[model samples]
Target: MSEKIEPTAAIEGAAPGAALSPAAQRALEEAAARRKAATAAPAPAEKGGPSGPEPTRYGDWERKGRAVDF
Candidate 1:
């Protein structure tokens, strides 16, 4: 029986079920790990600027600013 071929040139070294060569497998695993870590969470927004107030459950009605009627 013959081995099935993979589509990716990068992973061409790895077959469907066959174990990858040590160096190739390690590189692939490391790259995968890094990608996972990078996409794990969104970067935190910077704080302490007038960009906008953080959302609050309480309405801003407490402010004394003149109301604009539609």
Candidate 2:
């Protein structure tokens, strides 16, 4: 079996400034900014406000507001 590789190892190996063309570098920077913004945003308030009842954890067989049991 092949050894498992950490996801970030490939990212760390790249030199971002060395080979990217100007347009490619700009695109990369834009993507990074969007990623940062998404993570920094607050979690959305749940339905029915802060005092709402906790949502139910539906079973696997539930779909389209229906439940099926084998």
Candidate 3:
């Protein structure tokens, strides 16, 4: 059996052209600055190989330079 779905209520301060309080504006600016700074920072260089032994196939394991099977 199908049931009727009710419409969701609108969120406060989420409408287009809505004005935000000074505190809320400051918080949004700070969050945006932090995001920009995080993205501007350089990422660490990746190592050459896997950090630990990983399963390659069913019942098989592979490490830096060796493979084991059972």
Candidate 4:
């Protein structure tokens, strides 16, 4: 079956930042600054593997046959 497609209303030729209120603009700026700082910061160094074998709680898994009889 074919479906009808509808056009969506989109605002063009507008500065996206112009839609933000003063508080929202300030928050956006703060978030951008935090993101920039995070990108600029050095990443943590990787560590070696564990010294000993780790324990697990897993058990043997089996699938039982159906209970129906002929």
Candidates in order have lDDT scores of 0.56, 0.53, 0.57, 0.48
Worst 10-residue lDDT window for candidate 4 reads 54-63
| Tens digit of per-residue lDDT, candidate 2, span 1-70 | 2544222322323463355444555666677778889999999866743244332343346554666565
User: Which window of ten consecutive residues has the lowest lDDT sum in model 2?
Assistant: 5-14
Better of 2 and 3 by lDDT: 3
Candidate 1 lDDT over 15-49, as tens digits, reads 55665555666787688778889999799978753
User: Which numbered prediction scores highest in lDDT against the true structure?
Assistant: 3
Error of 1 at 24 (Å): 1.1
Best by TM-score: 2
> Which pairs of residues collide in candidate 1?
none
Off by over 4 Å in 3: 1-16, 47-70
- The runs of at least 3 residues in candidate 2 whose Cα sits more than 4 Å from the true structure, single-residue gaps closed, are 1-18, 49-70
Q: What ranges in model 1 sit over 4 Å off?
A: 1-20, 49-70
lDDT of 4 by residue, 22-61 (tens): 4555566677778889999999855762244421213323
Summed over model 4, clashes come to 0
Q: Write the per-residue lDDT of candidate 3 for residues 18-43, one digit (tens) a residue.
A: 55555555566677678889999999
Judge candidate 4 against the unseen true structure and give its global Cα lDDT, from 0 to 1: 0.48
Scored by Cα lDDT, where does model 2 land?
Answer: 0.53
Residue pairs clashing in model 2 are none
Model 1 Cα displacement at 28 (Å)?
0.7
